[model samples]
Target: DTAVSQTPKYLVTQMGNDKSIKCEQNLGHDTMYWYKQDSKKFLKIMFSYNNKELIINETVPNRFSPKSPDKAHLNLHINSLELGDSAVYFCASSQLPKRLLAGSYNEQFFGPGTRLTVL
Candidate 1:
């Protein structure tokens, strides 16, 4: 089984449209997360769900919403897509309070990522 999966590795859309990216993990984890990486390679945490509960919101725009159908899947829905939203969205999962401590890498793993392009 796939540890993590995200659909539409590449997404191209026009401005003002709605699009959704899906993610899933079979690792039996209670926490799942979404990260956005800009063209400059700046990684930022978007949303995190712990057992279907919204746990973290990193001041992301309202256009971006995250949904966890169950403990195994978390999907992202972008409303009114904008050029600014054209970035790589990655799905990840880990244990609760997951952190990459000093010199220590944790269990969190990322999906191949969905690259969004707005024109």
Candidate 2:
């Protein structure tokens, strides 16, 4: 079973079109997150959801929305997708902070990746 899995591992989209990426984790983790890894190899966190609650990233654009149906799944929706949004999105699973005793600093288990290409 995949600890974390994101669908459509490769997404080729045109500018201004809307798209979505689904993510699911089988690890029974409480916290799920979205991280964007750009061409520069820098990883920037986007959103986090737990127990069907949304945790927004202050730097994330309003065009990006995250939905969580349960603790096992978190999906990302992008509206009016732009060229700037072209990057690899990684879904990750981790333990929630409050419930963690130690050694839990978002030590995430990442999915293979969803590569988004905007043209």
Candidate 3:
């Protein structure tokens, strides 16, 4: 079974339209994240939720919103989608990172992603 999954693997819409993507994880993790990959394949984190609390990336525009109805699920909504918003949106999940003397790292498992194309 897939640890993480996303709906509507593909999304095509015109500019100015709104869209939403849903995600779920069965890994029983407490932290979930949303990431966007541009045409150039540069991945950047858009939002994160820990135990259902929002932590928006400061650089992300207000047009992007992430809502977590529960710890196991996270949904992303985009208002007034633009051509620039065309990209693959990935949902990921990970447990809280633990501090260690060497450092701390949280391994994130990513979903198949939803490809959004704005005409």
- Please report the candidate that would top lDDT against the real structure: 3
> What TM-score against the true fold does each predicted structure earn?
0.90, 0.91, 0.92
- Consecutive 10-residue window with the lowest summed lDDT within model 3: 97-106
Cα RMSD to native, each candidate?
A: 3.0, 1.6, 2.0
**CA lDDT, every model vs. true structure:** 0.90, 0.89, 0.91
Q: Candidate 1: where are CA atoms >4 Å away? A: 97-106
Q: lDDT tens digits, residues 1-119, model 2?
A: 76788999999989999999999999888889899999999999899876677765758889998988898999999999999999999999887754557766767799999999999
The total number of steric clashes, by the backbone 3 Å criterion, in model 2 comes to 0
Q: Sort by lDDT, best first.
A: 3, 1, 2
Off by over 4 Å in 3: 97-104
Model 1: which residue pairs collide? none
Span of 10 residues, lowest total lDDT, candidate 2: 97-106
lDDT of 1 by residue, 7-79 (tens): 9899999999999999999888889999999999998999999889898999998988899889889999999
Cα displacement (angstroms), candidate 2, residue 103, comes to 5.5
Which scores better on TM-score, 2 or 3? Answer: 3
